[model samples]
Target: MGQAGETPGRPDEAGLGARLVALGGLELGEFDAVPSGPAGASAPAGAPVVRTGEARKRGRRRTHLISAGVAVAVLGFFGTAAYLFVDVGGRSPSAAPPPPRKSYPAVSAPVAVGPQPVDQGVRTEDDLHLVCQNWYHPSAPRFRGDSPHPILISEDGGAEVDYRSTRTLNQAAFAGSSAQRRAWAPEPRRAQLVACLDLTGPGRPIRDCTSGSKVLPLVEGKYRLTVYEVSSHRKVVDRALTGADRACPFVILSSVGDTLFSAVKDRQLYDLLRERVEG
Candidate 1:
């Protein structure tokens, strides 16, 4: 049997060449025939090559999948961050209190007391001069006629006024210097004035006692002096004189033995008694 255009039963080389030329329409080409036996024929020369088109397409598909996965991961991270920020922003802050204000004092009504008569010519320390004067309510407490009165000294710049009870204790101390027992304190719990006020004005005149003080010459004996205001209340003081004239410059009102001190009785009685007392 013949294989394709091969000559069978004849090992004729010319016939094989002629068959090859007839099958391929070649112009009597010369070729060497490869012999096949127990030993196989040698393979054709040159290296084997694979096409790259399908491999390049598969690599591009893998790259696209990886990029999509990275994009999804980045988007999830950003969304989670935004959700946490919103949750933290939903809480509140703290609350606080208010402030304070300023303050002042209240006004009061004027007191009820009569004015005093100013004696301008009543100057010189030798004569008893009335520099200042004041008054108090009759119902006000009074320990004695010589107690501190509602009278302030202009020399102290009108800052304070002594009540009637305080004046009494001070004068008593002065008078009690020669007594058997000097007064260390005021008499315990006596009827005296509580408060006093100054009712003097600039129009009123005062005797200037800027220089020497007054001296009242008296015999060695004990004498009592009573002081009266415009009303009936009186203050009396029993003064003892051992030596010469004493400077009784300021008036001392007292209520020692009598119900009313003479100076605090009526103005006429006080004037009459003061004149009779012989300087």
Candidate 2:
């Protein structure tokens, strides 16, 4: 045992070396020198290197996983690029967006607004006229629902230009003690008084503005009214109506007419209408 291995020169050295050799392992600090591996079997003989079946399969699987990951990454990159550049749904930035529809806040309940001013005009409409199809004429002391007035229409109101001056509701050139007209409607030549809106501005009916040829179905909205005294072109009354108030677009016009009429100049009629409506 003495010279068969490297010497442990002293008795104490020999005893300590025997004890350490018997140990399975020793606890070590991070910076402590590590012992070399136990003496091992040498590589197999003739071919100089060898691989087991399990090791070969593990290497193949690792290669396959790397290839699959690369393919997925490539697909993801191109997909993102297509999404950023393509106009998938044909919507283009240059196309003008449709105008937003107008909306009005509903009043707490259907109520009247004013016989106030031309700037604050009443607007009423439904898909089709029911109660509102006609207008009232105090001169005739009756109401007619016919639009654009059988008489007293704007010069630009209809295609009746050929017979504009001569046409009447009936076949002949006739006289009517009663007449039907709207607020924006031009007054009869004989009316002598003008609508109140005539002084402020003209209210263009939706029917008048868009087509001007045919009677369009009424759309949902408030209907506005204004009146003018024909001869002096004096504005008698103008106001706006919402909801139920829309039932009578030019309700004030008749009362206002009373103040202007020579025969029935009831001055309180205009004030009475205003009080009722404004309430």
Candidate 3:
């Protein structure tokens, strides 16, 4: 059937019908009616359309990517935090213990000094005046029922000179046993006596003297004596005195001003002298 004015279907309509037939499983009747519109006003032909299934699949893939990125970031943050906690916590190798506090010895208080020795006699020799004193502690212990005595000699009105015994002569000479005597003998090549001489001028006194050596007359032997000069520190005399003269018993001979003075001691007289001097 044909309508005279419609012209047996428009060419555009025929093309649309042909396109509907070409589409797989689409019937021509389904798009047979087309709304009349300006050709340029409709959606552009052959543009790609997004299907629901493909859109949903793309959205899921995007969500999975975003979720994976977030998980990775979260894992990195937590891993870094855990690493920092372990490094900083407790006794790590990086953090060493404080060095042990330096331990110092305890300081002790100063000790108090006791009384000093007292001077006794004043004897004059030419231009030189001498003072000899005995120093002994009042409460000192007795030796063999006798008190111990130490002597101090001062020459030319100077400071006191202490004579240190090189060997334990005074005590050992009075020892009751022969074993003690052998033990108290002076060592070989060692000084037997030591005297500190203080020479006084108008200024400070000088204390510089070499040690002296003496062989006990009771024991026959050769010995050397050393003398020191104060004005000029020269070894003026290095002489040896050898003799076998037995003039005085219990005598301690000492040289003073080119003459030998004997410190004589007998048991009865010595007790009397000690009593008088000590008192």
TM-score of each: 0.22, 0.19, 0.24
**Candidate maximizing lDDT:** 3
lDDT of 3 by residue, 1-279 (tens): 855533344557547546534533223333432333333334347643322334434544665677689999999999988778766675555566887999999998988653233232212111011111222222221222222222121122122334422223344445545433332332221211111222222222222222245333232213233332211222333434322232333433343221222222233222322321222
Total clashes in model 1, counting residue pairs 3 or more apart in sequence or in different chains: 36
RMSD to native for every prediction? 24.1, 21.2, 19.7
lDDT of each: 0.31, 0.30, 0.33
**TM-score for model 1?**
0.22
Between candidates 1 and 3, which one is better according to lDDT? 3
Off by over 4 Å in 1: 1-65, 76-157, 160-165, 169-193, 198-209, 212-279
How far residue 43's Cα lies from its native spot in candidate 1, in Å, is 19
**Which tens-of-lDDT digit does each residue in 67-132 have in candidate 2?**
689999999999877666556744445554777999998769767642222222122221011111
The digit string of per-residue lDDT tens for model 1 on 1-279 reads 546743344356447546544444222212232222111324346522221335434544655677688999999999888777666665323322333555666667987865444333222221111222443223323333432432211111121333222222343335444331122222322222111212222221222322234322222222223333312133332222121223332543232111111122123222323221211
Once fitted onto the true fold, the runs of candidate 3 whose alpha carbons sit more than 4 angstroms away are: 1-49, 88-163, 167-279
What TM-score should be assigned to candidate 2?
0.19
lDDT of 2 at 102: 95
Clashing residue pair totals per candidate (backbone < 3 A)? 36, 27, 0
Which runs of model 2 end up more than 4 angstroms from their true locations? 1-49, 87-279
- Lowest summed-lDDT stretch of 10 residues in model 3? 124-133
